[model samples]
Target: MTRVMNAYYSNLIEGHNTRPRDIEAALAGRLDEVEDRPLAEEAAAHVRVQAWIDETSSRGDLPEPTSVAFICDLHRRFYDAMPEELRFTEHDGQRKEIIPGAFRAAGEEVSVGRHLPPSASRIPAFIDHFALRYRGLTSGPTGRILSIPAAHHRLNYIHPFLDGNGRVSRLMSHAMCQAAGIGGHGLWSISRGLARGLRDPAEYKEHMDAADQPRRGDRDGRGNLSLSTLTSFTGWFLTVMLDQIRFTEAMFDLNALQERYTRLIADLYPGKQRLPQLVAHVLRHGEMARGDARFVTGASERSARSDLGELISGGFLKSATPKGALRVAFPLDYRERLFPNLFTDAAPIVPAPPPPPPL
Candidate 1:
């Protein structure tokens, strides 16, 4: 139960004070956090981690600026469909805002202010290996939660998937943990860990600095990173991930939000066939509480309540009890998959860059 994964690569991490056992302990801790409240906000964090993991593990190379934009997209998508007001224009040259993802391609070598050389296109082939790598850590006969951090470091090293590399890389780590059962029926949200990592790359940059160094080559080695910095990055990253599992365990359960709504409307129309639809319409409109259910379903109040009530039973909509309000409730699994920062407000995640090129 305490198998440490990819331990030889410990040197790959920069400021590692944590042991393989420490990672194991963190995984167990994540489980305990959710046992008492299986479907609370905390569970949302676990789901969030898995979403990020899938995004990261699935892509390839990209330019630096593109990578940044890609990450912005992932964040936008992670939330519930996104409120129009939250959309920003400066994204991906798009006139509108959208979910962020990694670029997996090179960007303009220089901004308007600078005239850098034309950037090179990175290899996409690394994706196949990285994807296989995380799977090994997740499914092999001797798998462990440590793979979460390991995969993350490897993902960045590969630099697969352009724009959202950093965001997606962290997501991959969280996803690996969930698949590996590190969350114990819930999630350890490496994104939160990443939030911390982004807050301060110092400790993380210390880990795996050696491995991240630019490969010895002919050209383009001009501003490549050094081994020590890679090590620091690993330490800081793993430390942040360790902290994230604990933090995510304390958040609300995504299912609980929908269930409460379901229970409220179910009590109003126990035997209606169309309750589900009626409920869906009511919840969708948010402010349409006073409107007749017929507007939503072209049926009577009895018909509307019946359909909506059925939806309540089926978990499509929830009505306010004692207060008489209505709200939309997505499928539990759907909600978990889509809205990660459910309880938190939108805020930009800024990662600290590693110490400058080892002086």
Candidate 2:
């Protein structure tokens, strides 16, 4: 679910606000039900790329986040999963084909908003310099953490890819945080904060653009870009990250989370008195056996099975094999109630869809 939120917000930052239900359908291979097929595809692509990053990072096979290979691969993997028509981008009134994993070709330079990226010919040199500088940051957690925003802004400032630079840069930042061991194990997302936390997405772009300005006199540091603005952007970026962490932390606090689940379960299954205890058991032990349902609910064996079946059919729980251990499952309709304030379009509490009629 957090992964879906990350993907949704990342795409939202890029101005592709695919509905959460559509993204859920896309993940479930039900794109036929999605109205905005292209947007759903894009959101699914973003999720797939992040899954790849997490899997690769866990295996310790992920390349340096700043390395050109890793960065370009992030671009490649994302676009590779997108629909063909979405791979082409228009520039200067001419349609240009975007090659997966390839940098902008010479003479194919493009402008992003008010900023023009470096000439294609200089991309290799700029990328090499970028990789070298950030890879060798001071060996400590603080240095690693501080490098995140600096690298995020500078990578966008470079704009290596013609069309997907924003997404690529964001992915790179996520990779850097994970590499630094500060990514909260995918429990929270900075993209959510960046896209909506400030109440306006433009503020994020403004900060990035502010840091893009030329050096301000001498006290601003010797670099061509203004170090002060970069520092300001870094501060804002860190604040957003910290805010997300705190928000997620607060939501997940044991007592608070239990209360939320209790409320949600009651609302989802009104008057099913013992359902919450069964859910609590699953929450604590990760899964529960069919035989234990009666023990936990203290219901007659038949009634216990009926309750468990209702929870499963209602999408509150799932099992693999016939009579397998039951694990918790979060259906889309429950999201708003289960994780309030996490989404802007928090729907009013609604009962889970009724079970399919008897065949």
Candidate 3:
């Protein structure tokens, strides 16, 4: 048996270079300025705070800070392909804005395993729920850590953005952790867990099932998400996040790497089957011949060709015709340098630095 598993997500946050790794690297490189990135840990932490603010909304007279305007602004500034200065401004005085229904792309989806289409009509309330659940405010707006999984369910239910809701939702979950002062900067990235969800739909379903229901028949038993469900969802959320932290701490964990690549690829191609693998094959040598993709995936040449064409259409793979040769190029995110040991052409892989040496 050719026991190959999906490795698409390995590069989203950090891990070995595989097909998905190349794609994510490619996406980030294109979206982010390559020359001078802020410090790694610092950038990651800043992203979590911005993400949390994006997911929350003023509710229960709690001075909710999660708003679509906030989200849009944060996204525009933090994740935009252009410079941060051009993307966002002094948010302190920006007018509150709604996440336009035009947030998702024409065929975008909330989950690769499911679809919760975006609707402007239903978004406001959904945004409210996101900030309130498990939120305990001390001085500022609603604040609390309700576990990443709980927030993920509500995020899907609302389906705020036209295109990047899932990306925002996942980021929002990490933000929840950051707000609790537990990490100040989120300690984990759920992009890895999403990859696990892709590999085991059953496990994913079981986990989501616990936290996807309504709480204690509130006001005529209408809502589906319950407090109990939230707690259950939160528990698993922490566990999975911790798993990712530990796996990375250990220097190398193939399972975690596989999880990252699968999730990253899925995020790119939501409903497309075997798309992540297709992405991986293309990056075997940092590029692929469209005609040879079939050999790598055992699919017909037509199918292989279609895969490349689709990736090109999806912005994951770029096409360039070099003198006398046709090549499909893969995106490279230099941040993968964070893990130096995973590639063939670069410097030798070194053991990742020890975890802060215990306090």
Cα RMSD, model 3: 17.9
Candidate 1 lDDT, tens digit per residue, 1-359?
Answer: 10122210121122222332333333455434333222222223223434344444444221121133433444445333322433333424644433333333454222211212123254444555555555555555235454555566665665543223444555444444545546433334444334334445343444544445563555423445444444455456555655544444433333443344445445545654345445545544563463466776577766665554555566555666733566666553333222334323333122333332232
Listed in order, each prediction's TM-score against the native is 0.37, 0.92, 0.42
Model 1: residue 93 alpha-carbon error in angstroms: 12
Candidate structures ordered by lDDT, highest first: 2, 3, 1
Worst 10 residues of 2 by lDDT: 350-359
Best by the TM-score measure: 2
Candidate 2 structure quality by residue, lDDT tens digits, 225-329: 999889888888887777777777766666666677778888878898888888878877889999899999789999999989888888888999878999988
Please, what are the lDDT tens digits per residue for candidate 3 over residues 1-359? 00001112322323222343323333345425322232222233234334344334212121222445545554444344322332322222552232323454333333433433445565556666555553433233332543446556666566666434444565555444444444323324555555554235244456665555556766423465466656665566666665555534542344444445556668767876666776555444556666666777787878877876776665556656532223333234522432332332244333332221111
Which is the better candidate, 1 or 3, if ranked by TM-score? 3
What lDDT score is found at residue 310 in candidate 1? 56
Candidate 1: where is the Cα deviation over 4 Å? Answer: 1-120, 141-144, 184-187, 197-202, 205-211, 214-236, 247-359
RMSD for each of the candidates: 16.8, 7.9, 17.9
Candidate 3: worst 10 consecutive residues by lDDT? 1-10
Residue 84, model 3: lDDT of 35
